[model samples]
Target: MGSRITSPEDAAARTAPPMRSQITAPVAKMALSSRIVGRGDASFDGAVNIRVETSGLTTPPIVTGKVPAVGSMITEGKALLEITGRPVIGLAGVLPMYRTLTPGSKGPDVLQLEQTLDRLGLDPGTVDDEYDTDTSRAVERLYEKAGYDAPEPDGRLTQAVDAAKAQVDTARNRLRQARAQLDAAKDANVRDTSVQQGAVDDAEENLVDAQEADGEAKFKASTPLPVSEIAYVKTLPRRVDEVKVERGGTVDGVVMSASGASLVVTLKVDAQTAQRLKAGMAATLDLGEGTPIAAKVRRITKNGNQYDVVVAPNRLTPSQLALLRDANVRVTIPVRSTSGKVLAVPVAALSSGSDGGSRVEVLRNGEADLVPVIVGLSADGFAQVAPKGNAELSEGEQVVVGR
Candidate 1:
């Protein structure tokens, strides 16, 4: 059976309208999409930008060796490039290498170097500011792992050490001769014995001076680290973004640029929206691949009237990462949600009553009856509805949308 309806104008005019129609639809039982009021959609305009600057220094400053490939991940204690036929290694440290480090050198830079070496299992002894013999040996190991030879001390220093050793040997020989002479003079005369004893004492003192000189010379002859041979990076395992120097080109200014290995998505929002967001909040990333990826909020910063939000995606497979390396994507964060399923109806089915309360028309036994309802949430052209007072409403029920 079909439903019937009468218009107020037709009844008041004492005339029947030529045509009247009615339509019907069923109520929907589903979840309603809701979001925080005053919030807008967030999207990434482009890929993450890399801006970290790095450079190398050498005597010739010429790139005569292998360079890291662009987009490669560089780890700690790995060689970044080759300069002047020597490998320039990258180590983890906040302080930059400003001066050449050598034996007997002591400072905060040396301490940082020692810490880095120990982290790499190079065994820099004592991990102190003073670079001693153990530190020199550990540096040698560092160079060995990089497939290069450690720089040697100056030739003049090695020659001085040799000369000092020779002087000590001569003094020892003289002391032995004086002792023999004293032994012979002891049987001859007391005055002769005293003179020989004085000669022996003088020879012993000369030997002591020569030995001290030799010790100083040896200290100066330990291994040395040139400023150009090492580069200290604040973080390890960064991705190579740009390589400015080629194999035959000369190094000038910034030689390379790198940043964090993992990619991040950035977007701008209003201050109110930013306040609702915090670090580690879950989000969905849409790369336009027909599937959404999981992501989280990394940080939020203010810029002028707006705020910038950085989102980090979960660990992506190599293929997925490569596919979306430099592409734009959309992100969606849910700020509010319904607790469970509820009866919902199209917004058109809802109407305001004389009491200013919401109500819906339900079709029952070919009769239209008004059911007073309370609207919980309205979104996406749908409104969540619950029966008010004694009125009854359930899922899969037919409702009159028009008459």
Candidate 2:
């Protein structure tokens, strides 16, 4: 038996329309008889096929009906709503802050300045850029001495800028003087072979002397050796006899026809990056089998392609030395570490974008924020990202890895 309706009046009447029927429009009816040739029943699919055939399907209409609404509700015949939020979209980059170099910067700042100046071919006295009397005097003296045209005052070599300008002038003058000497020697009497030869030889010698002096000065100015190394080598000359007791103890200080083959691995680095891997630097050599051979940079060779860094073990056991001689041992050159924290970032997430710069996407609030970053020293797969102004960053921030 069918369930009974509670209302007595309702039981007599027919079932009312559904509540949803008031809000929903009636769906257009599809008649099966239309395909079978029935009257008053239109066929949209047939119409579409006919239109497509007539148009050749190559050129379609640019404009069409509006896309279906995503979310809509009716209050009366019409309703109104406001879009209250919007998403901001752009790429972000990470950049570094340019360091300020001025007087009164102490400790690391001074040391950095000193190192930088040293790298730039200027000595900032004792590898310490403090504005002491000695440093000021040395700098001023260097600037003045760097040129001959610049006046060399006996007492006060204090101002750096003036000294630098003076030094350049002096160098120019010396070069001019050397050129004049060479020219005068060329015009000397050639008929008197003996005298002329002697004069020419003298001029040539003078020029060579001046050039050697200049070259030596330039080298000294440009390449300041490490203080510790300099101190270490003070006791020994360029040639030192190594008495390896384990290699059978310096018998007669004789060369026993010692023949050993050194394995050479060549890695390429840019000119700027090559400066850090200078000769005599203590670098670690990773020989396979979980063992590392402590090595010193033997020499840096310049070829057409890139720097060929020759590394020799500072201390090698007989077995390890034999392995090194084998020439098939895989070696990894680890770049030396700096004293303290340098600005650094992940290597993968950086991209060189359209502006011809490295860029990284910073994730803020789950969205990509692009920032242009200045970079420095990249090693161990991590690069140093410089800070810009006061807007520094901390570790573990969500940096966008990719699109």
Candidate 3:
């Protein structure tokens, strides 16, 4: 700012205005304070919709039994519905049944089915890859008990079983030949024993492979879940949310809706607000004008300008679970904030000093002095600030909010 001074006395008098009386105004002060002022909808917690698809041999079969009611809780090994007049029981596994499991089946799908069968009280051989005689027998028993015809071993499956068995035999023979040769070499004045040793080493590897192949064969005589008894689900003991199939209805696609034991509430917010929410952050769940319960942010998935937030309750009783299932609820996730009381001032009190730094004018003894301060987290109407260096500032002291 350019100023013209007619004389030294005039310059001094004009540049420095007379000090005014102390401006007693509202103080930017604080007391033990905490604020959870964020607003979000409060509804009952919702459930996760798990698609219930059949896994038995038939692509689409008629539902022969009564479908589980919408509110029924189906535990592990419990039947969801009858398909093809055979009950497809729920089993806990990550892999869904993809193909028919007959004799000679060899894959993780088969392995999982085998394990499930064993767990279900139906012995599927050694519970390995091979659907051996034991696995075939188990499948037959399961179907027989269910009053349905068991799965029969197809020609191709039988051939596969035979081939695997033959390989094992071949491996065993080769090992025997190598061992005999090694013995002969040992008894004789064998030069270049390395060849004998190498043969023995090769035989050992062959025998191991043979043993694995031999165990992998699903035999016609084994009792396995004839591709009709197994049902794959992400988790066990899921509650049935809806039943799309009934007696005589097509059980081809998702015949029911289910979910895990826990229920959660999902909400979306703009990215800016999403930034304030974090996974595992504590939250307050409001169920209408009802009592509030504690919750935690279960997950936060970001998508462009939007964010999906999932919150799970800390605990829920059986009654609460039934009440809140699929119920819309408001979840309040407190933004990351300054936890406790701190020296603070009204943001309006802060002014840019001549040095371009933050400072507040302190009004005391009918005079004002600039006190430099470092600003911190702001919440509600207070901005956390600390006096910098020797700049005198005290807790509960009045600071000039404005002129």
lDDT of each: 0.79, 0.39, 0.70
Error of 3 at 390 (Å): 0.7
Question: Could you tell which candidate, 1 or 3, scores higher by TM-score?
Answer: 1
Alpha-carbon TM-score of each model against the true structure: 0.75, 0.30, 0.66
Error (Å) of candidate 1 at residue 313 is: 2.3
State the TM-score for model 1.
0.75
Window of ten residues with lowest summed lDDT in model 3: 32-41
lDDT of 3: 0.70
Model 1: lDDT of residue 54: 23
Candidate 1 vs candidate 2: the TM-score winner is: 1
Top candidate on lDDT is: 1
- Per-residue lDDT, model 2, residue 5, is 33
Query: Model 2, range 159-230, lDDT digits (tens) per residue?
Result: 433455455566566556656655666687334445445555655565565556554343223321111110
Evaluated against the true structure, the overall lDDT of model 1 is 0.79
Error of 2 at 175 (Å): 76
Question: Residue 52 deviation, candidate 3, in Å?
Answer: 7.7
